[model samples]
Structure formats: structure tokens, C-alpha cells
Target: MLAVESRFTGASGLDAMGAAVADALVPQRLQTPDPHRFTASVTSVDLGSVQLVRASAPPMRSVRPVGSPARPDGAAFLLLGRGARGEIAGGGVSAPVDPDHLVLIPGDAAFEVTYPERVEVVFVALDAPGALRLGLAVSGPLRGLALPAAGRALLAPALDAVQAAAAAATPADVADLAEVVEGALGVAVRAAAEPVADPRAAVRAAALRLVDRHLRDPDLGPGWLAACLHLSPSTLHRAFRAGEETVAAMVRRRRVEAVARDLTGPAPGPGVSELAARYGFAGGSHLATAFRARYALSPAEYRARHGSAHHLRRS
Candidate 1:
């Protein structure tokens, strides 16, 4: 869990903050552009797959580009507070981050994030798979723009949940919550991207992607997803009919598949309730109910039979 590793109100504190920022993010250059003394506080959590950092700092300019180790390995999402403001430019594209928008920074790609004023933001870093699944790695229409109103509405709660979970969650719990957070972000980002040419197809793609991201949330459904994607319940239904599986089936399948993947993966364990909670199941019983419905074995039994103790990591 992310704890307060350092806090300072003056130059000394800022210097320490700079070192902390570098350690948490990467080697980078920082500058105070306004000649102001400001207090900065940063709390961070690393969940193997992602690092979540919350920082409250004065105005500063940050430049991070392709450096040693060849551009690092992931992307970052900056969820700006209501009063936050900044500009991030890189790869020939520059985007402004006023109170209205969040920003995405690709680690491998050179970029500069400048906070023109004091800002409080939740910055999330995800590995390549997470970045691609969230669709933040591509230069889609929504790639670098401000999150739309609808997107922002959904994002706030997810960010809050993640922020809370980061500080108090166990490593296992953090991983699960990270998945949930990733799903929420994917939907939020997808919503802001340019809509596809075919309204029906676009909505379907977006709706399914949202469902895929939140498949584990017990509340995930047509109504909730419809609102997230700015579609009506009926529209959502129609979209699903045109697809291969109904929305409910897709959600169930995805959750079951995810659980199965985790169960069979190298770590080989999380109690039933713990595992269930990760995927939006109401509890162990709920997961067992679903697990039994979809597969012959119960979650526990299934894990016992197929679980392995091997974990693969990036080199």
C-alpha cells in the first residue's frame, strides 16, 4: 500500500519530493516555473502491474522521454482534480488539461506534462497490455482529448475507489482492484474517443468494451453500461442482439474466464470470497453459483484441479 514516505513545505521538501518523484516515476528533470514555494505531498502504491500515485504539488514543468532502458514499459493516465490544469505535448500532438480533462502519457513515447499551477491529480501507470486493453496506447479520436462529460462522470467514482483501495488493500486485493480500475478507465477513455462511422456498430463496440472492462462488477449491466456509453436501455438491447452474445451472457462469460485465468495462473490462490470480490461477484457463494453454472467444477475445486504455481514477469 502507498504510504506517506515524505512531506515538506519548503525548498527542502520540494527537493525531497523531486527525488521521490524520480524514484516513483523515472529519471526526469523538474523545474518550478512560477518562483513559488509550495507544499507537495505524494502517496503511491505499486501493484506489480501498475503504479498509482497521488500528488499535490505546486506548478512545475516535467519532461520525460525515451531514456535509458529504451522508453520504459507502459503508459500513464492523469486524472486531474477540478482545479487542476496543465498541458502535455509529445509525438507532434499537444493536449491541454484544464479542469475539464484527464491526460494520458505514453512512457515509451517522449512527452512533457507541465502543471501551470498547483494541481492535485491521480496518476496511474499501466503495463503495455493494460494500456492496450484500455485503448490508451493508440491515437484514437479520444486518445489525447479531455474526457467527455459522460466519461468524467463515471471516472470520478472509479478513481475514488482505486484511490481508497490503493492505500488499504492487500497485494492480492490491489491486483483485483487494479483490474477493476483498469476496466473503468478503458470504458471512460473509449467513450471520449471519436465515435465510429456506423452509429449502431460504434455503440456496440463501445458498449461491449465497457462490459468487458467491468465484467466483474456485480452491478455491471445494460442499464449501467448504457448510461456509461450514453445509450438507452432499448438501444443497448438492440446492439447486443446484433452481436454474437447477449450482454448478460458476455458479462458472465468474461468474468468466468477471468477468474479461470487467475485461478489457473502461477500464483494459484485467493480465497473464494477474495477471488469473487475481484470479479464483481457478490461473495464466494455468488462466484460458486456462477462458476457452477458455467463450468462443471466449483471455483475452489477447479483451482485445486488446475491451479499451477508459476508466474511470468517482464524481463
Candidate 2:
């Protein structure tokens, strides 16, 4: 828990705090009444399959405003309110945050949250694919769903296990525990909310599924997506209006992340230039520019730091 965690403390400026929080959790715009006296502390642990983040701050509002760039990795969050109280509004959902219930916010959804007093929150970050496999519904208007009592009963204990594992579990042990958490989350997701019936959400889902399949195609774009979906380009673009990202942006993000996985995976394969070409980048420099914009590191540097045996050998 204490070790193997990234920690941020005594951040005096709002931009500094925001960047730290974004690195530890998701990207958002953070504001407080008194910037001069502001303070926040964030600690995060990466468990390979999932992430645990705890943040403490004074009264503030965090917003991922509509039309803002979506989170590049497209991760969702399970938020547990620990101290004080707060409210979240946006993405077609409004909810209160308290210890009595758990809140689920969809990936890359635009929203705003206000902490009325000094607040503490713990968040579990899950990627889009894992969330879907666990039966957690990620489609529909970006909304926050509060788990019902029965669903809460199912998920709370698994979350407790995650917290405990962060304290002292071995990496392999934590990975095993992540699987358990996923299973429990799946059950809870099924029990929480019914499938949303909005047509826009449906279109968005269908388009995304197609995008996943065609990510490697350089011709994949808004026009291509619209053509395949039998929708007008405008309609296809409208489907994503509520989520604050264009189809082209999502496609590029997905491709970059796919290449990132290749860079960091255990077994070594192609050179960065070859990988860039495979992923639709013009060359190694093109991939490096895009990769750095999202991950803040060049391809070679990222591989050297996070890659496994073959990567280390090459390094």
C-alpha cells in the first residue's frame, strides 16, 4: 500500500495538483475557491489489471466539461466517498456521494463533481474491455449509476480485498485478487441498472464495436464509420456528441494505446518504426510524437522502463 504507490503531497498550485491527479486517476479540470490556500494529496497503486487511487482535498469542483478531450485510455471509475459529502452532475445522471452507496461513472463521460467540504475519495479504475467483460454496461449517455443495496453488498467485500492487497500483497497475489474483483464487479453490474434504451447510445456502441475491429485500417475514419453503420456522417458524429470525442479521435487513441501495449508487453517483436507502420503511423517519429502526447514518454524510453525480459535485454 505505502510502497509501490505514486504519491503527491503539498501541491501549492492548481495546475500542479491537476496534473498529479490526472496521472493518478483520470484527467479533469480542478478548481477551488481559494487557490492560494489550496492543498491536495493523491496516492495511487497500479495492480496491473486495475488501479487504486485515494485523494484528499479541500472544497473544490472537478469538471470534465462537455467537448473537452476525452481520456485517452478511456477508463471508467468506481468511486467510494470516504469523508465529507459531494454531488456529481452531468452525462445525463446526477447523484450524491456518501459512504452508504457506491457510484459508477462510465468511461470518458463528461461530468462535474463538487466537494462541499474537505473530501476524501477512493477510486478503482477499470479499462473499457474489462468492464464490458465483467457485464458492466459502458454504453448509453454518460451517466453515474448508484449501486443498489443488494449490489453494494456484492461489491463491497471485493473492494475491501483490493484495499488490503494494496497494503502488502505480492504482484502475483494482487493479480489474482484483481480477477476476483472483476468477477464480483460483473455480478454487481448486472444487478445495478437496466440497459439504457437511448438510440444515440446504441449507435455509439455499434460504431465503437466496429472501430475496435477496424482499428488497424488506415482508412478508418468518420466517413468510413458512417458508411458501415448505414448512418449519415453527421448522425454518426452526433452519436458521440455527449461523450466529448470525435470518431477519428477515438480511433487514433485506440490505435496509439494498442501500439503502447505492444511496446510494453512481455515478449519483444517489431522495431518502433515497424510498429508505427503497423498501427497506421507514418514512421517511428510520428508514433513517438503521438505516444508522448498521451503517455509523456518516447517509445524507446517507455519500453526500457516498463517492458519485460526481452525489452530489458534489448535495452
Candidate 3:
């Protein structure tokens, strides 16, 4: 579930607003030419595995100096731009934040962003492992440079969902929703990187990497891949046609194989239902049917025959 932890409807003074910002976001130095004239509203939410901070304010400068405490483990800040134009400098590089683009600022080091006009920005703090599980890590802090329009379009709905859910008292299955956003963020980051050569083999290779990384994502399929790679659906299909299996088949087969490995691993960990959800199965029954088809054994039977717990008992 997701819940709103704190909210500042309107804080007249910069100090008051700063206090709210620090409590929700990381501690930082906030300044403006006329502190008295400043007006702002901020809201912070705890989404179980993620944190979201939204701030609306007039022109200002915010800084997190060197030697500041590193962000909590697995945390990466995604600044989604909205009506804000500014410059962000971090790790000895600076980039502009315009309305058309998004910025990823990993909090493991120092960073700063200055906006010269009225600005509204949504900052999402997500787990690094969550993103890596979906096959993405931002190479470094990125801003200023324009991301592909198609990539930006793909990310819009995920961010919109988060903002819309902020008003609800408690949204169901929020962790899953958070992971979806993380996957979308990764796809956007990859899309923003240097373009790959447009060859059938290259497209197939790149698509394979994406498929392997996002096997656990329910949304990992042809439509999503086409958007991520900035190719038409027909073109994407043609690229994979000569392969052993279609993209859809690959996703299903890979997910089932991943679940089977988990079931038989030396560590007796997540149960059937948990594994099902983790690997993108609709439910335990769905996973059971798929597992039986692949290995000729129900998940429980497979575990009893080959799992770590079974081995331990035998020993």
C-alpha cells in the first residue's frame, strides 16, 4: 500500500518550506534573492519500497554540498520535469532541465539544481536493485540533453500514475506499480543513450538483452520493446522473425525457467505464490501449469524432488 506521510499546502516563509523539503527530500541549502516573497507547497509519500517528493515553488536554488550523507541504500532520485527550466550540476558536469525531458540524479554523490522561474517537479526515490532487476542502471547523472520523443512519451503514463495515486488514501498493490515505473525509467534511460546501428542482427541482439533483463516484467513484450527501441511494431517483428522463437514466446519461456531455478535453488526462499508474482505469473496456478508443461512436474513435486529443503532432509 502507499500512504501520504506529510504535506505542506502553503508555506509562506522559505525557512518553513525548507524544513518541509528537508524532511521529505534530503537535507539541502535552499536560497532565493527574496526569501520573504517565496511561496510553496510540498508533499511527501511513502510507497513501501519507494519514496516520492513533490514540490511547487517560485524561482530558487537548492544545493546538496559534498560530504553530505549518501542516500539510503537502493535509492535513486528521478526528477520529472514540469514547467521548470533550470541547470543541474553534479559530479563536475551540468545539464539543463526543460519541460520536455527527465533527469536522473543518483544520490550517491553531490548535486545541485537551480530553477529561475515558477517550477513544479516530482522527485521519485526508487531502489537501485529494483531497477537492476529489470536490467537497467543509469551510467551516471544525466540531464540537459534531450531524450528521444518516443522514450519521453513512454515514460509519461508511469509518472502520471504516481501523481494520480498520490491523492488516494491507500492504493492497492503499490509495490508492483512502483516496479513498473522503475522498469519504464530504465527503458527511458537506455533509449537516451547513444543510438545503436540499425541492422537486423543488431536489433535482435539489443532486443535479446532487453528481454533477458525484463523477463520478470509482465509488460515485457513486443509493444514495449518497440517503444523502447524506437522502432515500429512491424519492424521489430521482422528483426526477430529469423530467431528460434518470437519475442512473446521467449518472454514466457524465460520467465518459467527463472521460476524453476528459484524453486530448485539451494536457498529455500520465496514460496510458490511469491515466486509467481516475482516472475510475472498471474498466479500460483498459472505458474504451476506452466512449470508442469516445461518440467513435467508440479512446482511442489519439483521442490520435493530437487529443492534444497528436500536435499537437506535426505542428507
Candidate 1 residue runs with Cα over 4 Å from true position: 2-5, 33-36, 65-71, 74-82, 138-143, 194-315
Candidates sorted by TM-score, best first:
2, 3, 1
Clashing pairs in 1: 142-193, 216-279, 216-280, 266-310
> Which stretches in model 2 have alpha-carbon errors above 4 Å?
1-14, 72-74, 193-315
* TM-scores, one per candidate: 0.55, 0.58, 0.55
Q: What digit string (tens of lDDT, one per residue) describes model 1 on residues 1-315?
A: 543445656766666777887777655666775434757788877766667777777888877655523223334444455457777777777877664666666454566778877887776777544554554443231235567888788877777777776676666686687787787776776777833134445456556566666666767977787666545688778867887888777777788888888888666366677777888877788888888888888876777677774332211
In angstroms, what RMSD does candidate 2 have relative to the true structure? 15.3
Tell me the tens digit of each residue's lDDT in model 3 across 1-315: 354444333334677777776766677888876776677777676665567777788888998888787565334576776776888899878877765566666656578889999888877776544433334343355444356886678776776677567567356656666776677766776677733223555566556667777877778888998776667889878877877778777677878888777777776556778888898888888888988988899877787787876532221
Candidate 2's residue-wise lDDT over 211-255, tens digit each? Answer: 787778888889987776557899878878867688877887888
Angstrom error at residue 251, model 2: 14
Query: Native-vs-model 1 lDDT?
Result: 0.66
Runs of candidate 3 with Cα error greater than 4 angstroms are 1-12, 134-145, 169-171, 194-315
